[model samples]
Target: MFVKTMRDDKLSLLLTLIFSALCLLTAYRSMSMIAEVLLFIVLGIVYFKKSSIKEELNQREKLFIFAFIGFFVSALTSWIVGSGWELRSVRNPSMPSLIDLDLPSKYLLGALVFLLCVRLKWCLSPKVFGYAIGLGAMVNGCIAIYQHYQLGYSRVYGWSGIAEMAEASALLAVLNLVLFVFASCKKERIFYFVAIFLACLACIFSGTRGSILGFVVTFLFVGVMIFWKKRELLPIFFVGVLAGGLAFVPSLTLEQRQDTMRFDSAENDLKQYMQGNAHTSIGMRFEMWKEAIVMFQMAPFFGLTSAEIEKKMPEILQRSGSALVGIKKANPNNDARGKKHNQILNQAAKKGIVGVIALLLVWFASFRLFTPFLNTSGNSLIFSFCGVSILFYLIFPSLVGEPWESNVTLPLVTLLICAFYKIQKGQKIGY
Candidate 1:
């Protein structure tokens, strides 16, 4: 699939496009599973075909490898401690079963698959990659519109969990705007502009305030990059796109849906909480974070697993006293997700300090990986902009929910990470 022949390059490009198309659209978020199977096949082909393998590990790749290793180890140790050193635990959909490392492992596995793809030169060109992402976001935007207006849904989830959908919408918006900056042709440029509007609409319709936060941060990042690049005239046009994005929410027919974007009531939500009214969304999240703190205190190093966390909840809540009671009231049925509105806090309680460090390392390593492209040109410029800005969508939404740990999100991050590396490689490989 390398550039030995034009035919090989075309097939590689086609395959890459197909792979990119599968992101975030299917049940169980099967992209990672499919990537695992492909990686196994690639490994066997490399072993049997007597092909000489050659690729050096850069600082970015090495850091990513360590981060994922730490993440997997954290998950394993947490499960081990939670199981009481037992080899296996009872099966529960919301809990880890015996040897069940799939959650964290899938993230590492997805990265490996993309690394192999780059090694074989089976990756899209920067222009095509932009289109692939833009097209996917377009489809998701359509789905969001259909679900939000026609179906009378409160928000648009698009076959993913609420957090995943929120993160995706924000990510789609950010990337589309970035793509508009580095677009290769006039048609692509125009389409990317439209993508930005759709993506912003997705953000509004998602009703996840964190997505809006991410979008605003990314929008500013894009503007700064544009201004820094000395493309002074373009920022004026970009501002127009920003206005179109803001118009999406006002067009909504329902006041309640529009209220989702209003942060003015946040203070009121807090004041109500102080009066023992913890039903507001903001109040519930604050209370859940407090509970997570208690859980983390109980098992700071190894952390409790989901099952252990559940078993010890009553004891932890009793100790919490009247300082917090939203968790119990919000989840009388004791739903598995009662105490995890904030992803970082939830990680602290369940995975302990070890898992938390692993999570932070992944973010830090990714920061180092993409920011260097800031001084580049042509297609590689997309990497610098979209890659760094994408982290906002990944991390900000996780502040309010579990986007970072989502099946949909992990694979999407891995695929984009691979694309960034390979696009840089392609620059050297004759793109």
Candidate 2:
């Protein structure tokens, strides 16, 4: 019995270590992918070791799960109905067949990870999980700062493969928010302050306008939550402001900051787009959104395939007499021009109104789950802030870009949600 108990404890420790590694390696896509595979295997072993585990999902969790299922069903329907029914790519005939499967498969994998966390709650620690995420963000932040200042790169990317500076900035901003909340709720730690400073520096250097906006919004949200609970905590807020300002000052001198702050350019792009020009960045997004709306109108149920969308774009643009026609004609394989930049519209175009509904339901369920913990103190408050940070990350970036499509953010968010739920339920989680 003693030996069996010792073995079980060792398995639990191994699971915790894997979870930590997952958080630490999030910025590196390849490494994080390997960590996730290991996490699943470890979670499976732990799950099977615990005999006759009871279902522990609350009403909100159940709803979230059901909404995810709804999304899967709708997406699958669209894939089946639209696949092989559209024009084949002359350059790459086998491409469209596998690409459409990306979103659904990602969502399924995320759901699996969430479920495993929920099931094997005993093998997790919320404190360790939070620290792991902060440490990961800190590493990425340091790399980004070095890339921008030392390497003289215009936009810092910090080992986040294929993700743009904006995406990395948004990620660091969200992580910083989580660390701030954790710091406020617990005893002051130098590590938390260092992590937060690095994250802020990275965010500023990355020079992503949308992420900066998201950070401000998240900061306000955290401020309100913290102040509402303890009025005397106002000093901490001031200190954070001072620290963040000092950290961000150096980034303000970067030439990239000017480019990032060009709201006038974005406005001009929109004006150009309205005047039948779609060549600019903001203008191209406007064109894509318009095209997505038209696609949704034509096939309200299970919208057009990528092939159909690409094949039909020329006719559509020519009919509208938009400048996108010339652009599309010059570069027929410009998939970015064809895809929707907004997440909600993108989901609607891909899986129709049903997908939209499912997406909203999932958000609603997450909010429902998070709302209760807001009024609590101690660890619950920490969990609440983490939950709110994830929500902000999900909703804010999805408006301008497909944040969830990344393997890093979604998986990390799901794992954190599981850990937060365990904490909320008063489960004693240890590293």
Candidate 3:
């Protein structure tokens, strides 16, 4: 009986422990890799609990799982094609590989978390799960504040890059708000509220405009969900007004002095870039997107190998009427270090048609996983809200930045998605 109890205790802690460590460890090291290792450990333990996973899988869950598998498989297939059919991890990005299996492949490990959540729902603790994310965000927030004031860094990236810091914090802030709303007591509420504030501070300090877009989208999503629930136009109208005003938040890196919004000069930055000054923050991304489009056209079906993509840069740069002339002047060897800043374009350019289809499949299945839950009420509705919120949080920012490529963002997104994937089937009510 004691051994059984101890085993159950470990099972209860599986998700919480891994995710809590992720929020803390990812800032210092390569979290996706760490998470992969930890997930396999959990898998080994789960191998013993095969009897407990008696819940029959549904069609949607099955489809999502398959789609997830297909996405990674397609990427691997492309990598094989790019690596001349080599089956090993291609460490050199400038080498012949089509996909960067080094980090992006770890995204597949998220399937373990999803499956565990579905099978071991009985052992999971929502409070522990919620608070872990909240505390993690709060800690990062505190560090960002310290970096901003004491360390004298222009943008407080903490240990991660400014993009990762801003993007991830803004996402956590919104998710933490859901926790704040559903807290049973003052202590939980205080913890989540402080977490929300600090996370937002980190977002602002990191100053990624994409996080601001996340804020606007989140506000609009809330308003829409509210109206969808209450079926009232008046509340939605007010929410729209609030959302419009709140649009003043979220931006990418556009300044050296301030990490947050640079609305006053954002227009100027674009105008200058249009006039052959492609050094602005927005300009660099826009230029890359344009070149990436050209890259995609060159290899429309299977896409180019990373080496081939790098090879094409000289021709794109040397074109007589190319917009990249300023980029060349700004950084003569600016091949974007062989990466397109946009996720859609980057995937399309590097992995081609198969890659694009894989991406779409992953998005569709994942989003569909939470749609049915959103129609629920009470705590279930709140649960779905956070789940869907985390989804959009990943989706929007990823359009501009490759969260998959980041050391922390992919693991962060994956764990958050799995964390919010509440076990909704025939569970006991807990209001």
Highest-lDDT candidate: 1
Clashes within 3 Å, all models in order: 0, 0, 6
TM-score of each: 0.85, 0.86, 0.82
Q: In model 3, which range of ten residues has the least summed lDDT?
A: 239-248
The lowest-lDDT stretch of 10 consecutive residues in candidate 2 is: 161-170
Q: What are the lDDT scores of the predictions, listed in order?
A: 0.67, 0.65, 0.64
Q: For residues 1-431, what per-residue lDDT tens digits would candidate 1 score against the true structure?
A: 33444355554545564456654342224654565566547544763464564456677777777787778878888887777333233455454344336567775675566555545644455655677677766776787788876987777677776556667667777877777766656777778777777667766777777877777776776777677774753765475367446646554446654555656567788899989887788877776777788888899997777666556667777765534445464653353334477778888987889888888988898778777777877766667677877875576677787766766677777767777767765675564
Q: Candidate 3, which segments miss by more than 4 Å at Cα?
A: 1-8, 24-26, 48-54, 82-99, 120-122, 185-187, 230-259, 318-337, 422-431
* Candidate 1 residue pairs in backbone clash: none
lDDT of 2 by residue, 284-324 (tens): 77777776777788678887766666677776565545556
- Indicate the TM-score of model 1: 0.85
Using TM-score as the measure, the top candidate is 2
Model 1 has an lDDT value of 0.67
Which of the two, 1 or 2, has more TM-score?
Answer: 2
- Candidate 2 local Cα displacement, residue 334, angstroms: 4.3
Which scores higher on TM-score, 1 or 3? 1
Q: List the residue pairs that clash in candidate 2.
A: none
